[model samples]
Target: MEIKHNPQLTSTELATLWNTYMADSMGRCILTHFKQTVEDQYIAEIIDTALQIAKNHIDTITELFHEEKIPIPQGFGVNDLNNNAPRLFGDLFYLRYIEHMGRTGLTTYALAKAISSRKDIRELYKLWYNQTEKMFDMAIDLALENGTLVKPPYIDYPKEVQFVENDKFLGHFFGKKRSLLAIEITHLGTNIEVCNVGQTILLGFSQVANSNELRQFFYRGAKIGKKQISTFLGILKDNNTSYPSTWDSLITDSLESPFSDKLMLFQANLLSAIAMADYGTAIGGSVRKDIGVIYARLMAELANYAEDGAKYMIKERWLEKPPQTHDRYKLINRKD
Candidate 1:
């Protein structure tokens, strides 16, 4: 199909492009900083690929916005990064960071494609989806090669096929409970690993944050991350499964600010939103009543934390507004 750019972009198309551009810009800044500090060649290559994609995506989005006569968002840039600063984390952190980010990018881009109607918007999101999948694969391979990837617990194969005959299939709240399914275990392990990665990065952010309030926010995020990680691990232990190891010890004692506070806070907020959404999914996929309740409670906590982070961003005037329709009422009531 010969695709032509529509003179006007739909709201969905506009929002998707605007969000992707802002996110890619922030990602580029962070990856650029990581590029300067990463010592491993394999990890560096992955970051390089991701960084190039982000830069190219930002440029394309900028041109699209300009053609549409829409003002471009002032996203993060080199000024938001300090490449000469001391390394705040070890090489392992960068690898795991990419792993977490790649997962998010795949999810976001797919959803963007689904909601987009314009040919240009659909094609761009599809391209991003494929690109992010490759990036995710690289992250997983590098992590496995480095022995840093968290292995999910193994389960015994069923001796014979069986069908659920009673309510016990859903779960038991009072009596003895059936063992967790492998799928359930996979989601739990993945969420736990994500929290672990977030905690480690937040710990490093807390050390380098310049604003006292932002630093406190990072500390709060770390504390919540620690709690969530333990909660998931406890659930796994209840089923006699081995929990993944922590990566917190990989962070150094460097107090230098390698990233601007705006970049750091935006990242923290972004991860918090992603964590809450994943927890909701884990809850839905879970059969255990107790685990679902746990996810619900944890999501509430994360929602509250994310709200506070947004307020801080607005207070600091650092949050950029996304695209919206013009106010007809305001225009009609305007004073000359």
Candidate 2:
């Protein structure tokens, strides 16, 4: 296990590094603007730490990409941010944003570390995972301290571990459907939480975006997010469970552009992608037919939305070129 081979990067390893770099680049620009406009000193410190972590990862990943001879992605940077623009969101929302991002980071790095092959890449992801985990913890602490943290629903402790007795465990299309399993509740709660965060961000983005097309795209995404939130909340209410807190009121009325249209579109697209992944995971985890079917529909909607967002990005030439396979046909037909 100690042996280190400088072998060609596997597709999975390459993907994990490449994707992280792209997301991290966006995070760097976002947090930079956040750090500039933030008024609360406590929230400022957390933003600074997050910005530092994102910057470090971008630097490290760029080096790795260069060594592997893979083309670096044209991710966001100084040109994508306008820090002098008025604040689009308040301090509380900034902290809440960090909290949502921390949770996503933990999940992302964990998956990346699991799939990485090369020793160096695995080690790198592990380092990022540890750092991201720390950030999650700090965000949680800050959210709790600031009274912004939303805990999942509280259910009574089960009497004992009991197996499913019959077909009723999966529920039905007729009368008297079975109740939700604890695991099902967990996944539902998780999706709702992340969806709310997505909705909140989309709302703010739709408000201050400069380009009309970008504004429309964000508005469309926000509408989808709102519907998704309603679906999740209705499910919880039907099953008699508490819902998580909403930060929709945290947004400001500022119409000034804080981020470039490119940055805004990319962020919207990135979060929608993550939301799609989250729904897929939820479908896999839920055993209930209804839950799975609902998530499948939600995932489909997200896919369509993402496709539109990608086309918009392409039209605007904001889409970054990722590392891809060589064109064998083109090489064979070359005039040279």
Candidate 3:
């Protein structure tokens, strides 16, 4: 129950404790989507993989708990599921959800590995991290295969741009000129548009979800996306850049559709995950620490939301089985 950064604990104990907690958390989240429908076989397979990973971790942790005389933590159950949840989004969104969850999972497990002192725990984290990486890669492959993943416009390298430095109350502001701002602003606008589209899918799904809990989850996510959009807009404003008016107009034409609730949730999760990665990269490229900090926070928040959503979908049995790798040699030999 009480986990400390205690030096006294054994490696197995630590790994068991951490994994048990995570497994239970993930299980609870996934169980929410049990009995929900999936439109795509590939997406469904990926969801299954996500579920398998959660279930595997839970099983492992449960065994460890029993061996250690520690009571097994209660995992996710039918009680946590919303079988009657209404359809809130289309099928395209479900694929996006798997993609996002994979990215978030990779980042999270990597972080856990870095902080883990125990060798066994580190190895376990490594396994999960690798699994997440594979999941992300597969999602990308699937997206490319399906022609759904959006690629940002490529810009040729430009040399020598005039950047201005302005001193203000809080801090000194320094950035590229108005013309460059225009370019950056344009890209930011594109990201915002993608984000809005994803959020719309989620909102539509939440509106129809039969379970109040699932509905609330999607509603909360919509609010988060709105707040993030506003934050991004404020960043543009501070830089004397015009925010895109397109986000407001890119509304979903229909909230009710043939899409299952699980699929809708999946799509929403994927979009948010992609946004997190894109925004994080954007922040890293910015020269200003303040701006970077803002973007970083946004990325973290989005990752959290994606993870939460993925957990619920898995619990509800809406996820698909992930592709497995046979040998390292096979992977190395595969054509790019």
Candidate 4:
């Protein structure tokens, strides 16, 4: 008889699974609220789909943790939510939020699948990626049908293939520079949209956060988001390119807290982290020296904001520690 041993999950697999579980749990709570408050039937359908996906993720991760004998993370749950709280966002915001989640979900799942060594882990992420892709497509189609999708600025089609002539094509630091490339325009427009989402969500959080400190933190974050939006919009306008408008109106004036302060703070931190990642990506893709400088500066600001959030969470004991390798120094120093 041949004997085969099942391989254990790697550190990368464990970390990814833990993070996914936490995020999905929080997502479930938020989606549950959206499902209850959303008015449009079509938008409600999307919320229901997303809520189901989040629930399934929580269940699957729990099973995996049980099999591995790993203590399941105490992620967000019903206690963190106030379902009877009045609606804090418009239906359009809910739909747009789902679309943004789908995009980020694709990025996260793709990275997890690529880094996973265990066959089962890779297969799990692959399934999630495919499912999110479908959801992303659904969102785009629905947004178009509803006439709410704002596309990137259009440019005249190139008549013929052309090549960069000299270093002048790479934009300047002080003097007049070359026109923005299509890719540069796309990045600016994308960052604008992302900032709009962040600002709107933070604005809502600020209104309902329980503590004054939490409210201040969210208010500052929303301000940063608004500043970033203005910067991007100014760039697009200077280049004579059209850009998408902010979604500030999507937020309602509801002061009742729908989510716990911990959840709200975590979400604010998450959005800042995502914005930083996106700014870094924009820097990598941009050739314009000025544009790269702008992205770097914005990313630094976000880093500081995120650091403060981390400190606050740590102080409040709201941040859960992830798995870490054993401390070799402590082990060696101990008398046994």
Cα-based TM-score, every candidate:
0.94, 0.95, 0.57, 0.96
lDDT per residue for candidate 1 within 1-336, as digits (tens), equals 775647588888888788888889999988888899888899899999999889989999889888888998999987899988978888888888888889988988999989888877788889988998999999998888877787777888889998889876888667777788887898888898889878988888998899988888899999999999889888788888876776664788888899999999999988898898899889879988878888999999999998998898899899898888799999999999
Candidate 1 residue runs with Cα over 4 Å from true position: 1-7, 326-336
Query: What is the Cα-based TM-score of model 3?
Result: 0.57
Give the true-structure RMSD of model 2.
Answer: 1.7
Clashes (candidate 3): 32
Q: Candidate 4: lDDT of 48?
A: 80
For residue 123, what is the lDDT in candidate 4? 83
lDDT of 4 by residue, 40-123 (tens): 998888888888888888899999899989999998998899989999999888888899888899999999999997777888
The candidates, ranked best first by TM-score, are 4, 2, 1, 3
Best by lDDT: 4
**1 or 4, greater by TM-score:** 4
lDDT of 3: 0.61
Full-model lDDT for every candidate: 0.87, 0.83, 0.61, 0.89
- Candidate number with the higher lDDT (1 or 2): 1
